[model samples]
Target: MPTWDNVPKGQMTAAVLTNPGYSADPSDCFTYSTDYPRPTLPSPEWVLCRVHAAGLNRAELRGRTGAAPFIGEFIIFQKEYREEPPKILGEEFVGEVVEAGSASGFTEGEKVTGFLNGGGKAYDGAYAEFSLSHRRRLYRLPATTKLPWNVLAAVPMSMYTAWGALNLAAGLGERRKKDNKPVVVLIHGATSSVGVWGLLVAKDAGATVIATTRNTEKIEKLKAAGADHVVLEDDIDTEVLKIAPDGVDIVVELVGPDHIARCANLCARRGTAVLVGPLNKNWSAGKFEPFYIPPTRNVSFFTMTNSGPGSEDADVDHPTVEALLSDVVHKIETGVYPQEVVVDKTFALRDIGKAHQYCEENRAVGKVVVTVP
Candidate 1:
């Protein structure tokens, strides 16, 4: 068998999702499948990449737990386009292009990073030795990018997500007259991967940012991540009000449904509240009566759905995935964003169980990336 990097031409190693149960065990979730076939170039716009390192996302647990924000619909999509059994599990990856179809606009051997498509099977991700992505979605790294591939691996999904949520929901690039004014902003779940990048984007847009985190240890980290003010979760309301008595102009809510109401209520008149994840173990929000808010002081809610049409554009009220990726890459190239990648830890692909366990526990200060040797 022809091999490159120890992976056979037609076959590769992958962490197959053998059990799709929402159980409390990590080891019981993934199993090594050596005979997993490498994906063929699907179209002229597709590129086959050799995986270098794949970053773990909170969304990665959706399949195992069946508790995603869109798990039901994702399952339906998978059942419709079902292919391989067991399924490949992963999302964002940094890799070297092994085969770029003639129309892909990518060159062989170029280092690139981006996220997997949204439709089809949810598990056709970057957890394998080889994976596929579209040229329109992939971002080629800048020649001046000095970050290691392991660190750069963590940027694509999180950055795109953060940028989308902030720009789309919070109006980062909106053409309002108030756009030039420094608005008071609150970032919930301020230390999570998306939260950190959101903080940076908000700061760059000249908003005065107030960040919230339950972990006191992350306060300094959040500040370092460009948060102007950091508050513990319990102090969110009081502290945020103290900083912006009338309420914040925008709230980047990553903490999910449990605290969304409170965060929304904290928005100033016509202010925006955006949700990026459901990190608090609750995905669904229960119905409740409307809280008394001023007629002028109403808040609008938006969810960060990073897929489907116009998912890549920043219209007045939405963000395009492609635009955000390009912005983040350019910022990294110019050293405007932080050069250091906040990797809490790295795990060999073989030790994936331990990696999943760590992410499950939510003990990491930054991202947990799995490296492919």
Candidate 2:
């Protein structure tokens, strides 16, 4: 088996995801190790990504209370594709290409990361410090941005999600191009990583963005992040009404269908509500009074998962993902991504359970990344 210690500088590390199984927690789900073969390496459809960091997404939990990293739909392999089991589990990651395929330079010692499809299953992942990626699934990290392990690792999944939902899934501004201004926006779960990027996008598009959160302490942070108004997620009427008496043009929802009715009510004549969060929870919004929409409202609701269709584009087309990768590297090099106090607590990879518990408790904020040395 190959080890990273033997790999030269500008060489690649062999990685692994171990003994996958169905579980309710990641403690039972993931195993990270450097002991592994280089496989056949990629003749094509493969690039060796020298991972700097990997991010964790709530989606990784698969409703399992952080007990397990998610594995996508299983297929019984036939002649069309070769299948392997108990592989590495990860979707979004930031890394560098230490080697390239036959085609071009989305490879070869270039800092990079993106959304993964076969990552934890038929492919390798970032937990082990190096991984493999199909060329289409990765982007080169900007030379100007320097990323710390945690932010660099986490940014790909969350930010790309924001790009998919805000820009593509709901077409947040497709019809409003004629207007001198950007589309007016409402972003729920403002403090969440994806929510923050969504707000940034709306603000960048020149919209009057309204963000929501249940935590009052984050109001200042949300405001500083460019939210025009920060409202409590639980309280819809008073705060949202005050912000927009008529309605808002776009709503990027992360809390799920529980707020669908409120979102529907506040949607303007032709607004859109993009649902990118979990919807299986107890989200009974009751019923609406009027089933038809004529002179009143013409809102559209959509559901998007990172799988299916052009979802793979999160690795390719997201401008913010590029920015995030660049910014992390820049911060690492020039020191500029805002070092907001490392808090009173830090942990090692062995204490992953404690880290998950701490984060789930929501006792702290400002990034919690496990340092694996």
lDDT of 2 by residue, 28-106 (tens): 5444344544433444556776555555445433322323322332111111122343344454566667677776446
Judging by lDDT against the true structure, name the best candidate. 1
Worst 10 residues of 2 by lDDT: 73-82
Write down the lDDT of every candidate, Cα atoms only.
0.69, 0.55
TM-score of each: 0.81, 0.70
TM-score of 1: 0.81
> What is candidate 1's local distance difference test score?
0.69
Clashes in candidate 2: how many?
22
Residues 79-116 of candidate 1 have per-residue lDDT tens digits of 33332322666766888899998998889988788565
203: Cα error in model 1, Å:
1.7
